[model samples]
Target: MAADALPYPLRLQGSGIVLREWQPDDLEDLVTMLDEPAIARWTPMPSPFDIEAGLAYLKRAQTGRLSGRRIQLAITVDGGEPLGEMLLFGVTGDRREAELGYLVGARHRRRGLATAALTLLSGYACGTLGLGRLLLRIDPCNTASTSVARRCGYRLTGEPPIAQAGPYGPTSLDTWEYVEGLPGPRRQRLRNVAARRYGRRP
Candidate 1:
């Protein structure tokens, strides 16, 4: 789809949460949340996140939207302070496929924000964007994330052949697939494509 056709500053609302584009004022919160050891360990973020890195990320978030390749949104409550972030990246227009990634702040964990954000984004992707499928890669040991995926209707498709690279190094990862329709050859194709892209067994 064209860049203008897609929602750049997409805004999604849930029970008590809203997913909207990032703002300049969010830098401090973003850096603080991403600087946590847990966040660094789980995500591909800079080990020692600083203002510079945060600024760069903010820039990329804007550019990514304009490029029509990604949509990065901040998860907040009532359009207030940011609680976390959600992204729909690596979008393939013809195939109607994209990858979903999210991280909730340490202070916001265990409050169902992650699941709520996922559900909102899933609806926007399948309903607004007309995406056929969405993919998620999580470390197998991350029980919280695994649970969130399951709760969001993402089916376990097994581990990938290769591992996902983190700040420290690479580690084994699990692949999950979520789609609105029944699983078929198209779902399998998405699995294979994701596996290959992530250096996993295809």
Candidate 2:
């Protein structure tokens, strides 16, 4: 799909959280959050994240949106104070599927913010964007992320884990795939497509 055809700078709101496009003003919070050791270890972000890296990331996010490749949003409360970030990328236009990624700041952990962000993003992808599947690639060792996936109703596809290259090195990661529009023919279709794409049993 063309970049103009897709919704760039999308904004979604939930109970207490809002997911919207990244802003230049979010740089400080982005650097602070991504600088956490746990965030670097679990996510693909650069180690020793700094202002420069944060600026680069913002630039890439803007470019990705214009290219129709991804949408990266800042997770905030009441549309103020960025507490985290989330993204939907690696979109497959033919399959109507995309990957989901997110991280909450160290101080903001365990407050259901990530879950709320995921919920809003998934709803937008499946409902507004009319996408069929959303895939979350998570490290099996990251129990927190797995918990979020479960809470958001994502299922284990039973597919073999794959390796993701990060700042430290390559680490094996599992795929937690979410298929929306469940409980009917659409659900079965999504399940079948997910199974086939991820090498899971149908």
Which candidate comes out best when scored by TM-score?
2
Error of 2 at 34 (Å): 0.6
Model 2: residues with Cα > 4 Å off, grouped in runs: 1-5, 183-202
TM-score of 1: 0.85
lDDT of each: 0.80, 0.81
Clashes of 1: 3
Query: How close is every model to the real structure, measured as TM-score?
Result: 0.85, 0.86
Cα displacement (Å) at residue 83, model 2: 0.5
Clashes of 2: 0
lDDT of 2: 0.81
Q: Alpha carbon lDDT of residue 193, candidate 2?
A: 51
lDDT of 2 by residue, 1-202 (tens): 5743457758888868988888888889888888977888887888899999999999998888777788888999888788998888888857477899989999998899999999888888888788877889888788798778767878666678898888777778887778556667655654565456444542
